[model samples]
Target chain A: MLLLAVKGITESNRKFLSQYDVTVVTPDTITAQQIPEIVISYAWDDAIGQKILANPNSKLKWIQTQSAGVDYLPLKKLKDFGVVVTNASGLKAIPIAQTVLSYILYFARGLNIYASRTHWEPYTNQYLVTELPVLVFGTGRIGQQIASHIRAFGGTVYGVNTTGHMVDGFDEVYSMHDYQKALAKSRVVVDGLPGTPETDDFFNNHFFDQVNQLFLFINIGRGTTLNQNDLLAAIDDSRVKYAALDVTTPEPLPKNHPLFDRPQVLLTQHTSWGEYVNAGRTGGLFRLFEKNVPSFVKSGTIQYNIVNLDKGY
Target chain B: MLLLAVKGITESNRKFLSQYDVTVVTPDTITAQQIPEIVISYAWDDAIGQKILANPNSKLKWIQTQSAGVDYLPLKKLKDFGVVVTNASGLKAIPIAQTVLSYILYFARGLNIYASRTHWEPYTNQYLVTELPVLVFGTGRIGQQIASHIRAFGGTVYGVNTTGHMVDGFDEVYSMHDYQKALAKSRVVVDGLPGTPETDDFFNNHFFDQVNQLFLFINIGRGTTLNQNDLLAAIDDSRVKYAALDVTTPEPLPKNHPLFDRPQVLLTQHTSWGEYVNAGRTGGLFRLFEKNVPSFVKSGTIQYNIVNLDKGY
Candidate 1:
């Protein structure tokens, strides 16, 4: 079997993969005729992916993504090609959830204002996470991890998903139709929803209007899901007290954009998942790949994080 | 009974105290002749406190302070005068702990760098709190609260106090002499110690030299306990990775001070306890005062948060 491993696989990980009785090729060394049966990638190489799908003799069976969200991939084409997709979903949950809490605390503890002070200027508008109820959209692995962290801080967690079925870490679960009730009670709203046709522009003016109180809004999910203008409007009207956006529309959101000038917004440049990339010899991403590889080699199937391409998550 | 209630008592709290047949006098209304039997203050008025103590006929029986640390109060004089001193110890724990977590996450998640970026510049040096073990000095109410919050995030908490006695929230407890072992293994160190003669300059060059790894330092404790030059030296040598000081020796830390210019340091002034002050009509300070009032009226001693003058905590 042949595997195309991209850059970022550590030295030890490369050594660990050598015992699999498979030929591993890097992007720099691979030729057009050498389309591998399997590929491990982070940022999807559209040119290479298309070439593999185009060749009738291509043996591309599965793709292992190094990111929790696979929104940047050509999902419809991959689904049609019957290419099995497994994501690094639960791998980034710990750090991503920690970053979500960081955003919430940054605002709740007044670091959004205090961190910029050159002289001692005490701020009084600070709040405790325990004092505010949090409403998180998407009760998946990322959201559940976030819910657990919030619960640890004594904050009420209201998880939102397609169905209102209860999740383990959430105090209460709300369906998409009923999350507005949770919104009314929450002073913090976190978007952990994946990017899909349904989720695109989901958090527009109508969504922000449902909030009964001034709330802290955080987006660690997907940039395409947010309507940037609507967020700005929400801030201007005092509906959203502050926003900490880890993902923003058209990231590298042009320097002169109005979002950069807004003191109430904190832009993190979509780096939540960057923490564990080079943390140690054995990071969660490599461990996850190691776990999926054995099953894939035995039966051409992955045991975990199998993304349902048709539904787009 | 007469109670000198300084500024910041809400109208509702005043009404609650009025039902007990106690006359509440503000600083402006209280004359030298009308020294009350009890006083509720936040920033201790030395003039009023001294005058009440010197007057042999004065009925100053107890002092209710609205802060966790009563270090600013003349502990020796209060002990000599035989007046009971009760502080609002646990009242600020939740918000202050939240602030402490805020400081930790601010650096761990790379907000200290990313927050200032006008353009999209993703940072890779981000970390998770769960990846680091924390060593917190002073395992009292505030330290315990911080421990619980860190535990919730799956981080290990090693607490320190006068004795190596076991504490509920900490994974391990160490005495002042034995904390060096915990410090060696920790990547985060927090000072929640009280300001006293023994604690003054306690976290100096000798203490910073004991750390085995590059660490994040946070001080939510009294500023006098830290030696600023030692902290700066630690930062210079890269032993201290980052620092967040909520308290400084001579605050308002001057605008031209070197501490203000250091990108690695985050100065929050001293507003961790300021959150719940004006939050609602029934804030924690008023509630603490209300809890202590009935006990003080019935007996000369208070029920909770009685300060140990000799220990100065």
Candidate 2:
């Protein structure tokens, strides 16, 4: 019997999992004695999850993460134990892409300024989408999805990756070492890189300075890659016209944080990945399960979106 | 010498007009004495314009209007006087389309609510642009252009016109009499109709009630086409989710109006048809002048966007 862990498992979810001989468990009902029986875990980042994964006799042959990033989880421990880690990455691609498009449209169409004004003084800064160029950092699932949406809307997109590899939906690609060349032409910069030690503080003052034009910054990735102080300074210097941060240096930024009060900044409160209706996040999790559970049952392995332990995506 | 009427005509503008040996005139400088000698008038909606148009000895052969709609002008008198009226229509299509798109994207990505929240609880009503259905009223130049932009962004559009004749960029077309069928499936309703006796207050209580589901209303057309009280009632009844209006009944809305304070309504202050930069409106007017002036010089007729005195558009 496969021991699966989850949260708020409903009757419909149970009906979906009834095809296999599996026993579902939750944090409140689980105990240390049951750790050795758990063959798969679908939840993480909680105190109970850490204790469960810490078991020496844990039978976790595979783990499915319901989130896109896995940097915070025990990557080393999972690799050492010979367990395969898979993530639900592409599931949130379109939703997050929609959010990114909103930011670009908000600025390009002058809605950012129009919504605040009380008079009939029309803005002169509006431009067609085809006129602006956008640069996206990290040509991964999220970045590629964002690029595709931008392309569909008649905008130009340049992508940044480790090796400058070509990707669908991007007009051009540049390696991280030579990304400044791309930044010079982009009017909007998007950060979609994952959180890793090597990427920490990657978007420093030097990175912001390479942007020669007034631009909008959209950060939908892990917050560790950006230096908040430098971002504030860039905004102050007028190098950045505005910014929309779905993720920040710290979660639940203090009530008096300056970023919350700025007209040029929009704080989205990190809810890009979760939706309260239409089974948004939960629906994606189930889709990942449907694709992986069948493979894991027969070969003790999962096929889709398996995170590279070394890269920590 | 050609007599021209304008507002704030700059030195650069005079340079453009100097090429044709034209005398530029504003409302303050013009008089009935020059009306008989005038062969063209380029300004409207002022005391001087009325005087010139009313001039019994007016030698006016053609009037190049600086606006899209000709309903407010003396169309019957111009028709009787045998003066051709050409308008600057296509000039503002892209900007107004951008404004309409801003409203759609704002709702699709939940930026409408996300930008207002005081805490970290993100909104979940978000959906991709490609998934929503948009219904456009009046399949004229602006409507077709807005529909095309929505199509480029992957959304489906249904157009409502007088005859329901097929138009590009729309998945289907519905006649004005049958517009209710289109509204039933639309997640967004775009009003691009002109201000005419037949169109005034057409989008009244009955029209808003046809919207079975919660949706956004974008009015980039003439404000006279909508009834404000019914719109406010629809919002109060929870049938309309949100609204973005670039035009209103009065030129400058009262400072303490309720629409200004509504959380669901965004007043863009009649700016969609004008842009601040790119010499936006003036640039369009000049292009219209260049096209018409050469044609008028060759023949006594204008070659572009000649308004029908009977249709009044």
Candidate 3:
């Protein structure tokens, strides 16, 4: 069954589900209406968590989310109701990693400036540019891929990971707790962390204070992980020159939000996942549902199921 | 030695005896003064031919140019005078090739348009882009390097050369005769041809006509290879979507040039060789001169030494 609560997927996704035996159910359709055997949850819709938690009579057996982070989903409520929770992981790894590299190259070459019609100067070509080091938080598959691509372009790649294993392309890899040292050494910071309670406010004023001038910051993973106050303070202090965020807290971030009008801040409407337009993979949610239903029913445990209680994505 | 000439090196080129021993001289610098032992001519300078043809100096033993193209340097005049001409060939291959790939990515991913602060709109995170088919006009060292770098970034590379030999990273290789067909099929074109009478207007209106609307043209070789009138016509016809030029006739193309006003064109003041500003290499001319002079004096021939007076580099 298709779920409307998912933030990034909607009417277009429902059309794709029609190809299968799935039917879309919006918040209106799900209430005072017939219930389906399964209900999918989009990571961005936490309010639906309360609705699903309040109605145990519908007998929901499976809960699938369209986002990689399942922390926001009411995993405890789903678990109490014996509902299985799974996420749309691995799907965003490549695209998100590619987007990270795009930011790196954009900052390194000053390409955005060069490509602009206004900055198009003729004699200014004789000027030189200094290269800055990039420090990436998290060295998972997406982070490794980002590091490799950045290194290919003659960039020094540094990363922070739980294991701190010696990765191939990273000039230096550090433990997660050692991020402070990495920040001091880097002029560019990329946040690609999975959002959990531990991750919220990971990039705060303290983090920004360590970044050098003209420092660039980008976040593509979770909006809640960033502290709006900390980011604003950092920009005000001129410690961070610019920030390009794909994900932000309270997305469709209010018009009056500081980030929306902040100088040097490029707030994207979370397009890192939008490459699917040309990829022709918009039916991903339904496809994932179709693939997991039978297994979830037979095994009583989804193959890629996420446990909210354990907080493991 | 640095050579700064206006029109071309003159007959008095052989008169500057001590000026060039440690200093650089152009045709302009030698007019009212004595001729230096060494004269530097760049491929960008079309006036070199006139200077050499007018000078009948047998004492001029060496000529060095700041340009990679040796075609315009008076090969016959220097040969008859037993003066060897060395070129600054390999200096710009890397940066020029990098710029070429940057343009390819800019076109293929539509980054050129999206990166614009004034033109960009909020886009969904699920957008994907199709790759472009790129054609390199000259499959020499710079072309080969450009093809390699572009292919590394997941681009299809096509190359054209005199011999049509197989290149490692290119999907297709064609001779000059097949260039028209190649141009017809490719979405992007990069011309690195030398400025010879034969090559003048190589990319004329007819060529621009064959280019598709998706075409992104780049010229890093000599400006004469592209006819200004033809390029302007192509821009008007909308045959080329974006054009990035590092070299053009009339270096500092007049302020009133139509291209300066074209929105689709990005003009760089032929400074691809300014690698030193980016901490790449310093004093490329002096290094090239020092390395090739002894070899030219010993073997009486130099690599990248252009000879065909009819072709005119």
Given candidate 3, what's the lDDT at residue B129?
Answer: 21
Model 1 misplacement above 4 A = A7-20, A36-44, A211-213, A276-282, B7-21, B36-44, B276-282
> Chain B in candidate 1 has what TM-score?
0.93
CAPRI quality band, candidate 2:
acceptable
Worst 10 residues of 3 chain A by lDDT: A122-131
Model 2's DockQ?
0.44
For all candidates in order, the CA lDDT equals 0.81, 0.78, 0.63
The DockQ score of candidate 1 comes to: 0.58
True contacts kept of each: 0.67, 0.41, 0.23
DockQ of each: 0.58, 0.44, 0.28
Please give the distance, in angstroms, between residue A274's alpha carbon in candidate 3 and its true position after superposition.
Answer: 3.7
Which clashing pairs does model 1 show? none
Task: Please report the candidate that would top TM-score against the real structure.
Answer: 1
The TM-score of predicted model 3 comes to 0.78
Model 3 C-alpha lDDT per residue in residues B1-313, reported as the tens digit of each score: 4344432333444334223343445555455334333344433345544544455652345556666787545566566666556566666676666566555544444444446433225554232223456788887778888887666556678898777888777889898777776766777788888776767788888777676684688898788889877888888888877788878877767666787777788666665544435333334555455455444445556565544444444
Candidate 2 lDDT by residue in tens digits, B1-313: 5656663556876777668776676656666577567777776645665776666777877777777887778888888888888887898787788778888878777787777666556566567776678999988888988888777766799999889999988899999898877788888888888888889999899888877555789899889999988998899888897889988988788777777777888887777764435535555576666677755765666788888888888
Give the better candidate number (1 or 2) by DockQ: 1
Worst 10 residues of 3 chain B by lDDT: B13-22
